[model samples]
Target: MLPPDFTLLQVVPELETGGAEQTTIDVARAVIDAGGKALVATRGGRMTARLEADGGRLAQMPVQSKNPLVMLGNAARLVDLIRNEGVSLVHARSRAPAFSALWAAQTTKTPFVATYHGVYKAGSGLKRWYNAVMTRGDLVIANSDYTRDHVLAEHHLDPDKVVAIPRGIDLDRFNPSWITPDRLSELRDSWGIAPDDPRTRFLLAGRLTRLKGHMTIIEAAARLKAQARNDFQILFVGDDQGRTGYGEELAKAVSDAGLADRISIVGHCDDMPAAYLLADIAILPTTVPESFGRAAVEPQAMGRPVIASNHGGTTETVAEGVTGWLVPPENAEAWAKAMERAIDIGAAKRTEMGLTGMNRTRQLYRVDAMCAATLAAYERVLDARRLTGKRP
Candidate 1:
């Protein structure tokens, strides 16, 4: 055998610029780079442009619909797409699309894979069963060791079938040298912050959702009013993504805390590397466990002290005291304490820790490393199927 030529099909709700969306782009790019065909089948969105720009074909369909009738319709459509495109593998990034993709993959006799992006905390029995399909992937890609273990515990799947492949950031894109003070200053100009000011910027980047811990960060910042108020400014980045009501809640929390000025809701940052450079500290104060904390790693690679709540993959992302501090999840007081310590420990220790973080990022979380590992898993599954003379 020759290196098997695979027409990879990625099914997701929409091509939005979330972590899973970004990962889908990565996989498609890798497929083309590795001499395979990459075809993404999804309801097109903002990210669709970039997906096609990178030499991947986009097959648009109403994949976002979740109703049973809509899903079965989509499955029939996907089966047609797969058969016509000669897709050798089907990958679903969300549970909604997974229901359709699973049926399509089964019908087409293609390998099925799932990238478990978030921890689906089952609110009810039906929901739990619905989320359980994440465990049914021929190869389940978890973003972190924390997430891999969580999937094992919650879904009760074979550990061998679940693989930990953290979200990857291009080091060159996130490198400290790549973003300059001039660029950082330019972003500050837009944000109305003085370039010469010695004040620190504590940045939080994510959708303005309740689970993301914006209120918790604001509350913590308010509690720290007596300390680091002048030097530290909290900046929230990320568009509401239809969570305007939640944004209102955050605004109310900020107002109640009297941190209206100090806590800037800088929605949807465009230049994240520059945004990281503009910050003295980076934090992901999510209440629930993030399957993998993509927000934490970029700042670390940029040599910024990152403080994330001790939930989800944050424990794995931040090397505790080495990269930054990890406070108890949702504990505003504890977050306040950690923020104080991270700031008060002075710039020298911070620089040392930041360098350590950069080293860890360089060693472990390179995009190429992630791509290689992921491709290996795909090949393993394919080879097993080939030996058995069965379609995966």
Candidate 2:
């Protein structure tokens, strides 16, 4: 017999190389792997390749256009597509696309799902209403308990409607044992580091947004660089995402600190596992609470210690002394002090922490575990709909 014919549509603003975008691709692949029809609809971006490569169909839609008329047109287009393709459920990943998906789901009586991936702050009523779409999903997915609580506090959404499905990481891809020595050497060389260098490599991976706390990290690095007792390299691996000026400002800060030789911005790393393997430590210094810190978990899976700002999902992912350190958010001094602790811990202690982290991540945050939970949630949603004899 053929596999069950349930169609799932994932709507997003764009498919770029970020935590959320990567999850979209992974979830799409998971749906197909589970013998379902996986369809991704978006404005189109870098992530489309993985979606199509996973044997999922891509439906290009400018659901991200902010204009009222454009959103209405997108809604109509979505409605037609949903009807034509017999989409069983429509999932939206962002506000712009959520509006269109909401309209289409309402019109076609399909299940509407939304995943809240960030701690979105509302500036005004209009912005709050715009973000309300996320809470309106038939079955809302919160990337963390922190994110779930935010939804309840901000939108007054029902507790039952909001389900916590923490973001998943691919264990197989991130396994330290799987990372080849040649790959590590290649990445080290590409980053302009000598293979024989005794200096530890520290990485800060994220888009160069103000919220990422690049300046804060740079300040911390300067302190480390100035210390005569320490030797280390800092690699900032991510594109600026239209924040060229911010990137330049950060570069200037590094230059002014006289740490230019040890600090480099390596843009858009394609081989993240290799990059993580080369790192002695990973840092995430976000000013805002990350709904889930993928950077924290990925490197842990690679048996590299991670240090993150103490807030949001990192509270659960990074176990202070067990996995890595968690410093006060946006404090350069605190970050620098943590860096010193990391450096002082010695190789044997760091190795133990990395091993503990690897086991912890495998048990709790594996991609397969995430995918299974998601599908189980979908089943529950469908079952509830059947019982209620209601159509969204």
lDDT string, candidate 2, 109-144, tens digits: 888889998989999999999899887757889888
**Angstrom error at residue 109, model 2:** 0.7
Q: How do the residues 1-392 of candidate 1 rate in per-residue lDDT, one tens digit apiece?
A: 21656788999888866788888888888888888888988888888888888899988888888799999999999999999988887888899889999999889878888988998888898998999876665789988888788788887887788889988877888988877777877789888887677766789998888888888888788788966466678899988877689888888888887887788887877688899888889998888888888899989999998999887888888988889988888898999888888878988898899999999988988888888888887887788777995434
- Of the candidates shown, which would achieve the greatest TM-score relative to the real structure? 2
TM per candidate comes to 0.95, 0.96
Which residue pairs collide in model 2, if any? none
lDDT of 2: 0.86
Off by over 4 Å in 1: 1-4, 226-228, 390-392
Candidate-wise lDDT, in order: 0.85, 0.86
